[model samples]
Structures are given as structure tokens and as C-alpha cells.
Target: MSFLKRPNDFLFRTLVIVASVSLATLSLLVIYSVVMRYVFSDAPDFVEPIALLLVIVIAMFGAALKVREGGHIGLDSLVNKLPPRGQLVATAFQHGCLIVFAIALFFGCLQMVEATMEDRIPIIGLPESLRYCVPVIASVCIAMFSLENLLALFAQKQK
Candidate 1:
């Protein structure tokens, strides 16, 4: 009866671990840099890129988990008062909106990546590819979340 034995539980825990590690490592690095900067009067040039990369990585992994856990911003107060069938309908509609948002974001991200190929960050001069990969990952996460939600909704109806 371990929760992680369930497939969804396993996936959810894996995602949570990954996101937590990414953010924690970033936090530690930032703290170390700050300590060095104050104590030794110097810091490495790579901190900014590393920090930004950590932010993107954490956000990409965390987004799907947030959606799966129903942690995303929502108008749930109104829907909460509805009857069971009405709630299901509302959920279906809400998931439909999520699907559309994901699709639009996916396309928009593609356009951005295409337009920014020649551009580069000023400080790190990292390739635009590195920066724009975030949107691509985010779009995929959002799509996955929407699919999972719909599946859950369907299964709920059967029960």
C-alpha cells in the first residue's frame, strides 16, 4: 500500500525530486557566490547564466506537477459550488482551455526560437537555443498536464 507504487504517484514524486534538486542547487550556488563576493571581494562570471538556467529548469519540471496537483491559479471558488455533474462539465471545459493555451504557447515558442536564433545574451553570450528551450519545454509540460487532467476526468465519470 505504498503510494509511490502507483504509476501516477511515481511520476509525480520523480518530477518533484527533480524540480527540488534544480532549485536547491541554484539556491546553494547563489549563496556560495554571495559569500565569496562579500568575503573575498570577487565572484565568478557564470553565476548569472547558471541561476537563469536553474530557474528555467525548475519552472519546466514544476509546471506539470503543479497542474497535476491542482495547484495552478484557478476560478475554483465558483466551480466548487456546482453539482457533481456540473463540476465535471466545468472541469472538462477548463481542461479544454488548458489544451488551447498549451497549443498556442507551443506555436508561439516555436516562432520565438526561430526569430531569436541570431540573438544572444549580453553577459553570458549563451546561444539563443539555450534560452528559448524553456518555452518549448514549458509547452510540452502544459500539454502533458492537460492530457493527464482529461484522463482523470474521464476515469472519474466511469466511477
Candidate 2:
């Protein structure tokens, strides 16, 4: 558990940094695109696809980070109203659901990646599958984070 803690901390920090950078970059890119389109009347063709990629990065990474922090939307008020054991059960169930969803997302993204590997995004010449790959990575992180939460929940229960 201690070993997992170190790696999980590292991963959380890394995701935070990645998501922050992606958001900042996306904002600047959009601003630049707007400026170029309205002021210069010469918006770069690559901006749209690049922005789309950045958006995926920001969204997927942000969602994973939120899960680790327990910041995502939830029925927390109802769970909190339960007795200790019931709260534990509810929390574990939530984590289990997240794990299931993440696993499904991962496999679905893998299929998309495989199916679209040969297709390229217009103006960027990058594989169309690159878009789905971000979600695959995020899904793995989501699963790991959910598992970590479940483990922590049971450990605390043992006390």
C-alpha cells in the first residue's frame, strides 16, 4: 500500500500538470485562432485539429484527476447520511462502478484506435486514432485511482 501511494501521488501530480498545461495551451490556441481569423483573415488550417487534440487532453486528464480527489459529481449527501458501514458499502460501490466504467472505456477506446489507425485527421496528417488514445490513457488512470480509493476505504474500515 505504501508503494502504491508513492506511485499514485506521482501520477496524480503528473496528471495535474499535464491537464493544466493542456488547458492553458488550448486557451492560447483558441485565442490565436480567433485573432488570425478575424484580424488577419488567415486562420491556420492546423489550429482546429490541434485544438481538438488539446481539448481531449484537458478533458480526459481533468476527469481522471477529479476522480482521485473525489471531486466529481456524486450523491455524496445521501452517502454521508448513512451509518458508517453503509457509507463504506456505498463508497465501495461507487468505486466499483468507476472501475467498471473505466475498463469499458479502455476497451472501447482500444477498438476505436485499432479501427481508425489507418485513417488520418485532416490538416494534421496524424492518425485519427490518436484522439481515442488519450481516453485510453485516462481510463487506465481512472481505474487505478478508483482501485486506490477502494483499498483506502477498506483499510480505514479495518481500524
Candidate 3:
């Protein structure tokens, strides 16, 4: 049933919501930080790190959502020129590469977080590993999306 795609749909919707909220929060935080710095001559030291975290969350989640939506940039015109089977092959290959890249990013971030667990952000006292967590989560989302697309492609082929 079409409901089989619910997980990917859920993830895409969740990422979109999270990214939208994070972007709005980031904008407000930036404005507050600027006002505090220029008007009050006092900006909270924690604001910078918090904004950075929000930025990472917004960017990565947005990117993963774009991947899920097939909104990422590509040479689609070239792919479209191929025959139907060729198009399917090209699309599958593209998503397969995405899966591999996402897997690599996941482990890379994992190692980075492990290496930085001892370090803390001076302002917020948060573990430096927190900086890398967005990438890890985004990578998981990207991998899931790509895997779903790949499976769907194969299913189409079978049909």
C-alpha cells in the first residue's frame, strides 16, 4: 500500500517543521543579540553559541528535507535525455551515492563528537560534541530518505 511510504513522509514533514522553527528562532536571536550589543552595550555570551547551534540545525535539516523532496540541484536535463530504463539507472545510482556519502558523514561526525566530548563551549558550557550532533542526525535522515528512494526505484523496476 502507499502507506508504506509513511516513514519517509513523516521524516520529511518533521524536518521541514524543525527547520522552519529553527530558522525563525535564529532570526529572533540574531536581532536580540544585535540590539543588546549596540543599544544596551551588553550581549549575552551564550547567544552566539546558541545561535550557532540553531543555524546548524536549520541548515542540516533543511538540506535533508530538500534531499527527501528531490529538490537538490542536479544535471536533470542530462538524465532526462536518457531512455526510461537509463533514467531509472541514473536516478538509482545518484541515490546510492547519496547513501554512501550520508553513511560516511554519519561516522565522521560520530568520531568528531567522540573526539570533542571532553571540550566545552566556553560561553554555554555545552559539550563541544553538541556542535557535531546536527550533522549526525541529518546524515541519518538523508540516509533513510536515499534508501527509501532506492528501494522505490527497484520496486518500480520490478513492476
Candidate 4:
């Protein structure tokens, strides 16, 4: 088994389940909202904001898990054709870029959360900062995964 797999098994599986269930719930919420609006001429005020939150949860956590699995979409056709050393260089570059991006995103999310702490969603009155939670959490996960891959790359070279 790969070195990274065991370490993340529990968290990764939990994230997968959460992302899947959230997406399913989002779909149902939207359907119910549409039906209520058309049939009753009124819909629950919570539906739209909750759906928006679910979208962020689904997208961010799912993307983070994909990063953990090293399965995030990439342009690999040219990289695959490179010689072994060239491929290593390309992969290291990619991981480096990912690490930088993840760190930047994490901090950006933090700032957003801080700035929005007092703001509230119109319907639920939940703090607007809650929306940034997914990005903040997912960015940390992405950064860790990228750093692990970077370390593994160097470890392989040493061996």
C-alpha cells in the first residue's frame, strides 16, 4: 500500500461520505424547494442559503479528497511522455505550485471568515463566516497532501 493511504484512511473516508450525503441532500432540498414554490406559492426561506452552503461543502471537501488521492485533474499527456527525470521535475513543479496555492487559499479563507464574522445569512441568521469553513478546512487538507507528496518525492530520490 502507498505510504499516504493508511494515514488518511479514516479522514478521507469520512470526507467522502460527508461530501456524498451533502450532495444528495442538496439535490433533494432544491427539488423540495421548487415543488413548494410552485405548489404552495411559498418556499422555506432556509432552502436557498442552505443549498449554497452545501454546494461549497460538496465542492471543497470532494476536491480535497481528490487531492489526497492524487487524482485531481491535470494535463498529464505531455508529462507522461517525458523521460523519468523530466517527469519527476514536472511532478515536483506541480506539487510545489499546489502547495503554494493551498497555503494561499487557506489564509485567504481565514481572512474572509474574520472579516465576515458579524455578517449573517438572511434566512437563518447564521454567521456568514460559516461559509468559509469548508475552504479553510479543505485547503489545509490539500496543503498537507501536497507536502506529503513533495516529501515522498524527495524520499524516493534519497533511496
Candidate 2, residues 84-122, lDDT tens digits: the string is 889989889999999999999999999999999999999
The prediction achieving the highest TM-score against the true structure is 2
Per-residue lDDT of candidate 1, residues 1-159 (tens digit): 233226556667777887899889999989989988998989978888879888887887687678777777677998899998888888888888877888887888788888888888767887766766776766666666677778778877898
Cα deviation of 102, candidate 1, in Å? 1.1
Query: Which candidate achieves the best lDDT against the true structure?
Result: 2
Tens digits of per-residue lDDT for model 4, 12-66? 8888899999999999999999999999999888998999999999999988888
Per-candidate Cα lDDT values, in order, are 0.77, 0.93, 0.88, 0.88
Ranking by lDDT: 2, 3, 4, 1
Q: Which stretches of candidate 1 lie over 4 Å from their true place?
A: 1-14
Give the total clashing residue pairs for model 1.
Answer: 0
lDDT of 1 at 43: 91
Evaluation by TM-score, superior candidate among 1 and 3: 3
The superposed Cα distance between candidate 3 and the true structure at residue 79, in angstroms, equals 1.0
**Over the stretch 72-153, how does candidate 3's per-residue lDDT look in tens digits?**
6667999999999899989988998898999999999999999999999987899999989889999999998888777878
TM-score of 4: 0.89
Q: Output the better candidate (2/4) by TM-score.
A: 2
